[model samples]
Target: MKSKLPLFFFLILSMFFSACSVNSHIMFKTKKNEVIVDNIPISPADAYRLAPDDKIAFTVFVENGKRIIDISSGVNENSAGNQQINKTDNIQYLVRNDGQVELPLLGLVKVGGLSIIEVQEKLSQLYSANYIDPFVQVKVTNRRVIVFPGTGGDAKVIPINNNNTTLMEAIALAGGITERGKANIIKVMRQTTEGRKVYQIDLSTINGLKYADMIVQSNDYIYVEPSRQLTREILKETTPIISLISSAIVIISVILTLN
Candidate 1:
């Protein structure tokens, strides 16, 4: 039995190395000059344009004595001195097929190819034309990105509440990566006018945070790859069962020979 000790050790060592040497696909490798230095300003990317079936919210800003009110009052008084339900209670402006939403004062405003900031500026201008010192705030209420955490985890849609939700933020909002997830390998898939664009990001290193800090776009697909550690753990768990089965087979052979 002791004579097999060297063979057992060799097999174990081979398996360990094999598990460790599993090919892992990492993303966003640091460039030659990609060093983490201070005073590096990160400019935010452009805002998302409104699409069909997208929901938007328009808030009228009012300034008072040292205080500002966001007219999101959530309630609207009717002309008949009765309280009427406001369908825009949540400030959701449903974008119609014609790429326009009818506002209270401004009718059929075109907002298809415009960003949230651009829409806000346009709304502010429209409001100022009619109302006194109108300050309009426009936003896309239902902006979201889908996250695909590989390894059989449930895919989730992460709402982009802020216009500048980053890759790390999306991961965090989706309850972070799973135990089988590889932090070093992350892909962000975004749709462009020409075609779909994919961006790879590695978060295993401190410098990789630059890529991880990249802004996520609406309807973006984020995928986190599986980790090799999970495969190693599975192999480690099955090794004992395999050894037990082999021992049982050897015992049965000995018993049969004795019978």
Candidate 2:
């Protein structure tokens, strides 16, 4: 009975947390999931577009087989010198605004928003004047994104090259979901000078595109909330239950004898 007194308290506490638990996944849905819920009211992805200050890497290959690479696209003058040194086959490039990259032979060419294949073709066409059948491969290198999951949970930072980064890729970077992590109703808090905007990303109904492995963008912040596991697991065998129960019984018997 003395031991169960602690068990009784534990059960009561667990119930308290369960009562407070909220099903937030249904509350916040990704733009895609929301539209599906409400009969496809609008296309949300259309609103998402890349902007400046976005980190990207660029790679350039010349006809004679000189590969020029530039990372940290925003401001990397060093890349020019590095380009002159490396004449190998692999060159990674970061996209520069004014929508172009600096090539040794073809100064600057517009490359923003173009797919990798399109960029390669554009570069080949520009370089063909001097070299025959140029081999060009373009990729984005600094696709770095930071995820800050506050209140709900922890934060994580992720980086990418050219390709779109997904959601799960960000989570795995933070050591996977914690015992306290919530899978369904996680909230995404996005920050900007216009003030922070809170968006709901429901993992449960996010069809096709998986959230955990979802690709992230440059400077993007992500948050994962603590699941009720935190509250429930608290004081739950944080100490050995057998030892705790034995101590409680001894103490109770001593008090009974003294009385």
Candidate 3:
């Protein structure tokens, strides 16, 4: 019996393991396009806007290289612009009360709601008034990402160096989402002087790819939640005893079929 018992146990063990592999564990009915239902969809990029508290750096072209060279030499140090990069050839400003940033030579100008490119062009036109052929370059220095609470998010703020960050990009940076993360349900919360606005985004559909053009701004929070299917699947895999039984069943089946 002992000798035969080993064979029996082996067969049973293999079968048990195989059972687990087949339908024992991680078994749940998911809708069609399981991956889509399971994952966060990306949105399309129509336009990227700006908000307050966003820090920006601007550089005005010094045609004769005198202003550029002078500023680059560290003569007049700008607090905001100096914090931006290595030299004073640039102007740094945060979006203030009137959605404007005060510049050294250019004074205050409203920059919110305008894209970086637009800002550069506008600055060029504005600076051209003072400097000849002023070539302007503007960059968003401090980009803030928002994560919502109660969903797959935490009430936290993430800072980004580049302004061109997207929804997915933001999520990936924040340790991705938890297992219970609801990918399909993501919200990009924004605050404006008028009021607080919420841009609901679907990170799990093709349509989301269209809206994903949501360029993350400074102090904006993005909240992610878990989908039902993903939550269920996660719960199933976490069962220790069930997984053990499944493993045993698989081992038995392997032995029986091979024998």
TM-score of each: 0.59, 0.46, 0.51
The RMSD (Cα, Å) of candidate 1 is 8.0
Clash number for candidate 3: 46
State how far residue 254 of model 3 sits from its true place (Å): 62
Model 3, range 130-237, lDDT digits (tens) per residue? 666666667777666666433432446677766567766777777676665666766665555545455555656686676565567566667664444643444454
Best by TM-score: 1
Query: Candidate 2 lDDT, tens digit per residue, 11-92?
Result: 5665556445444332233464332222211122322333333333334445434433332232222334664434322444
Worst 10 residues of 2 by lDDT: 35-44
Task: Write down the RMSD of all candidates, one decimal each.
Answer: 8.0, 9.9, 12.7
| Tens-digit per-residue lDDT, 1-259, candidate 1 | 9966875786677666655645434333334344233332233344568878888876565331122233444232333322222333355768898898877767788998788788888887877764556566676778899886755446699898886678888888888888777777676766666466556666878988777667788898888877556566647755875687579769988999999
Best by lDDT: 1
In model 2, the runs with Cα more than 4 Å from the true position are: 1-94, 149-153, 161-166, 178-181, 187-221, 226-259
Looking at model 1, the pairs that clash are: 56-93
For residue 14, what is the lDDT in candidate 3? 60
Error of 3 at 89 (Å): 7.2
User: What are the lDDT figures for the candidates, one per model?
Assistant: 0.67, 0.51, 0.59
For residue 132, model 3's alpha carbon misses the true position, in angstroms, by 2.3
Global lDDT of model 2:
0.51
For each of the candidates, give the backbone clash count: 1, 26, 46
